[model samples]
Target: MDATIAALEELTPVSSSFAPIDDSAYIRFARTSPGTRTPVLIFNAIGVSSELFLPLSLSLVAAGHSVVLWEYGRVGDDGDTFFSRVQSYKALLGHLRAGLYDLGLEDCHAVTLCNGASVLARLQAELPFAVSRAALISPYFNLLHVPHQSPYETALVPLLMKAATDEGGAARFVHSVLNRGGHAVASKEALSKAHMASPRSIAGYSRMLRDYRRHDETDVLRRVKGELHAFYCLDDEAVSTDYLEAIRSAKPSIGLSTYAGGGHYGIVDNPSLLADVTAYLGGDR
Candidate 1:
């Protein structure tokens, strides 16, 4: 992980270089190989900050792909800010287009997970020319049945946010969320390393889940014209595999893959899942 830390630290200076076009948050992207021209755009899940995608992004970069990871301010904090939400999506789409243009990319592949899948689908429907293929990882289209901010969860968010902002709060929060719960997949050591790498980003993450709920993504998914890959975890506590299957059934052309054991955050803990994803993205069966 020392190499990852070095790469991230070297990237710190370039963090603020990608300015936002409007109210949307600007993203910090790291390319492993500057000379490689493979362009890939990533839209991250709402509940987590873009930093969470870094591990996978770096892996893709190592495979000779230039990756762009999008950040959407604080997720649930913008619940009441409708204009900001719209502008954020618009700005993100703009950023994707501009990045492709600057890279001289004719077509690009995009990947999104959870709530991001819906966002990317909507963008693709609006501008079909920009995206060539899409991959949705453990997508959450509806929140009604999915695990969401119950009264207890809602109350815990602010407290967690407060603690996450305090010194060593990130470590405390990750331990409480991932280790104490029977659902935790990552070891304390891994969580500790992640916390040290991106501390303050957790506050933004907690706020993203403040007013979180689920909604339908069928409409957006139907409009996406590119080759689609939908990957889901059967053990996911937040979303049901039935829903994912329904999406696959509804879209005959869309390809589906299921991982039986990984929980919602399996994508983080399972290297094989990333390998499968990389193969799919590379047009391998």
Candidate 2:
């Protein structure tokens, strides 16, 4: 790790060249980094929507690790129904693997946030890969195995699917319901603007909730072959401590990193989390 960072410092002798992308919807790769250390491959939380994980990806790249943001936009037919299941990730895993081979990043450290970790964990269990380490940030999986009381997230799966399919009517209904109930904070305008912005992700979330049993995150956690690390904010309103306890019960081998604050999306909003994850992925741990 030191050697890789040394190589990075040698190559990049100036300030960090991280560019800020609008809405955090794009990915930027490391132009130069030693491949001796494992690469960090991020699985964007909501299928092709890279917004949630973009900050961490940028941090890892700035820290001189080759961070590969996955490509699921080209998946499925015109990328509409992509990432609907673990098989979807399986399909692109080969493509991602091929890209890694081309770039000499075959050995990897898998990093994902929220629901995407479900698919990623299942991928490792069903079809093992070369991931030596994994980081799941505020993961919400095993919906059936665990208990949840979020009306908008759980009870409204069908309605959410409708919102994804026919956004005109259902989106407003959902946004109104969730917003009125203090569930989500996206502006009504933002919700409306998301009409066709990420149909694939919207649809996939519906499936994730509807078919939660298929993910079997508990089994995946128990069966994971690498050093699995799960991060969470103790006070996260969205994902509570019960979920953390469930993960511990499922697999005692997995490591847990809990913080007093940072909430659900702390990896993006918290500077300490950004630095900690960057250091961990850079092989400092």
Candidate 3:
């Protein structure tokens, strides 16, 4: 247990604070020390807590940029309403915007991964304070376009529930999601974090997988005004090449960074990928 705590401490020493989105819910957020440039906001994939992005956060902080890591709102089963969900999304963004305001940042760069990328781009079109620039890692513009995909093809609720309660289940799920292409391995810290996730969070991820097929960001992408950068992992199983190709075809101006070796999560931890992200955020590219 000492070793595990030490490992997690090395990964993410900074702790998180609660930022309220409403009376009933709040987002878990953590910020690193300010860097030479504007702060960066990082959004994780479904079922992936802010802890998963600690390596990236550490890198950004080392590069002299403050980084913010946030988890999405929990979706409860009792009062599930489409309108309520939409409002939650809006409130979440407002909460994020508030985080920036509290930090005294007029504008900052956004780094979003997987489904979070889609969510950010969609909300950016409607938000009052837009990100100055954005970096996307293994993004999905449309969940339906992923190869061999279907609506709720994977039973995430039960699996995540099991994972939350059992260390072995958490290890299995973490390996399947994070360690892809036989390149990445699940860290003990990662597994422990997965096992400690709240049931509400697990339900939220299940709901996202079940309903994400209905929300397409094509129109939102067209209207997005910020300078955009996308990183694609060739071996990532969860995302599709077709969706990226379609995005590139539709938006010719968006910059793309492809990694032949790094898997989805691995790419975020790669030094080269981090350099590219920092460059883009710094307007050096």
Candidate 4:
């Protein structure tokens, strides 16, 4: 683990406070501020908790902006008994926005990573009044293929689930995934630290992967009103860049940036990528 990330992990606090959206669901978010009037809401990847984005969220807070990171249904240590099984993505966004409003943040910008991008895009489409701008890192609107139940993933996930219940398991899973791409953008060391900080995050992430295959948003992208910025790594093995190009072409007005390499989780691995996203959200691009 990098010393800087380790130190930041130590300083960051875990958030448990939540607001009920319905009898079955609620939202949890983390807040940090540098006293900026304009707040930024970060929608994290499906399985990972909002804590995965803490390093970057803290940077945004330090830069004089308020940062809010939200955890989706079934993704955290919070109770999941009430989580809706209906797959209503729009309702999920509404729940999250209500939580943000409760925090006294009205107008806001947004940043989303991986599968979280589609949710953010859908939110902009459904509730244009709340969000002003968005930045998507390693965005994925669809999976390249429905992951078949390989004996490897099927057998491995259970073991991963067991180990991931503690700090050490989180560290191993993060290392294993990041290592697959040679740590070009997200170094194995950085991922290891993040895992130790939030061990059970993979369970949520795995659930996300399962749920995403059942949801599609081609219609929503064609209707978004907010300015959108998308970043993709050319070598990403997880999701195809063709989807990014399709989105860019669908909305020619939307700005797009592509990097040479960062595999699937590159956004977490590279701070420079976040810098680009921050600039776009700030209207510097």
What is the TM-score of each predicted model, taking all chains together? 0.63, 0.66, 0.69, 0.66
Q: Lowest summed lDDT over 10 consecutive residues: which window, candidate 3? A: 75-84
Clashing pairs in 3: 35-64, 35-65, 36-64
Of candidates 4 and 3, the better by TM-score: 3
* Better TM-score candidate (1, 4): 4
Q: What is the lDDT of residue 86 in candidate 2?
A: 31
- The order by descending lDDT is 3, 4, 2, 1
Best candidate, lDDT: 3
Model 4, CA-based lDDT: 0.57
Q: List the residue pairs that clash in candidate 1.
A: 76-208, 142-215, 143-214, 143-215
CA deviation > 4 Å runs, candidate 2:
1-36, 74-104, 125-129, 150-158, 161-168, 175-215
**Top candidate (TM-score):** 3
Q: lDDT per residue, candidate 3, 233-272, as tens digits?
A: 6666555566677777667778888887565665444668
Which whole-number lDDT from 0 to 100 does residue 251 have in model 1? 70
Cα displacement (angstroms), candidate 2, residue 272, comes to 1.5
- Model 1: per-residue Cα lDDT over 206-234, one tens digit each: 43343333235566557767788877777
Q: List lDDT for all candidates, in order.
A: 0.54, 0.55, 0.58, 0.57
